[model samples]
Target: MRAAICDDQPQALEELKKMLLRIPAVKKVHTYSDMNNFWATLKDGAYYDVVFMDIDWKQDETGIDFAGRLQEACPYTKIIYVTAYTLDYVEDVFLNHANLSGLLKKPVNQEQLERNLEKILREQSEAEGKLLIYYQGSHIAIPLQDILFLESRLHKSCIVLKKQEYLCNEKLETLKGQLDGRFLNCHKSYMVNMSYIREFRGREILLEENHVIPVSKARAKEAKERFFEYMSARM
Candidate 1:
């Protein structure tokens, strides 16, 4: 999808961009360090499928103002508010807009970026979340939003997640397609959803759900890229 990230923090913006590269499907990702550049791009009719805005930027216009203007300009493009400070009336602020995708708390992490990301992208994907898992004697439908990561162990595969793991015979490739870009291949044997990710240490990726998945020696770069793209869209 075509998307943009708008924030003032260079380090944070760079980190967000880095994570998004892991996904092979992202067509375009534009990063803006401040609102002026971003607003100019929008004024020039540059639209994105999604836009991530840092709510507390020092721009003359706040993210809320930009979002409202964006709603008037491009109603279809999803608006996601990114904030470092805790917001009390997030819903009220969103109500004035046309259609809001969702919000992200700042110092944005992978999982947080991904959680509501697929939620917004679900409609954008040609095929909305179609991940079908056969587990516990029934075909358990795993929404892209609920997934953590899929782990391959030896000849078999294990699904690691927050609530529970459903043993399945499905291959990662097939499931990955159903996922769209919300989940990515971080390791040869491991596929992860960016929404559940917390932090990516040298080899270990922490999940907000508290599970730790190892980034394989061969897949570390791809893993990092996945995180970057995901966070970039999050802003």
Candidate 2:
């Protein structure tokens, strides 16, 4: 992941940069002692996946204020606050901004940094709703929430996403395991993502895009029970 870091202290900036470089997931990192330079680089179309910003500094605008502007420029960029101040002093302001990924205390160790980075990256991936699926010679990340259902076609699997059907080599059981609680095995040959369910007509389930899937007689009772439970949790 491409990253950017800004801290007024030169030693702190170097330490943070060294720690980030050790992380295998971090592809590139840009460090700045001046917030203006950092902001200017981002504004010039420099792409960064994550940014480690220090909140407390003797600057005109604090990191919290800069974060708000960063959100306006790149809403998808993840901002992790590295602050010496207590969260009590920052939480109120931090809560106002979206895409606030993590809050780390000063003198952070390698373990703490790794743990926070793992959580932030995982949450970022999930928030994007992408699911990794591998096919014959290639792999792809399909948006889980956008998938309507999966159908078993002979020896191939058909993923009903949006209004498109893509073929996969995996079976129904494999797909079910890869998916989260949002998908239900409504039939022996079909699995439906609950988020796309529009209605249930007897043994047939209506999904988004006017798609219909069958609910086996034996599984009908269990399906309804589970679906109701899912809806209840959402409510």
Prediction-by-prediction clash tally: 15, 0
lDDT of 1 by residue, 152-178 (tens): 665345777678886665445434445
Candidate 2: regions farther than 4 A off: 127-235
Q: Relative to the true structure, how large is the alpha-carbon lDDT of every model?
A: 0.71, 0.79
lDDT tens per residue, model 2, 19-74: 99999998898999998798677654576778888888896888888787876665
**Residue 37 lDDT (model 1):** 82
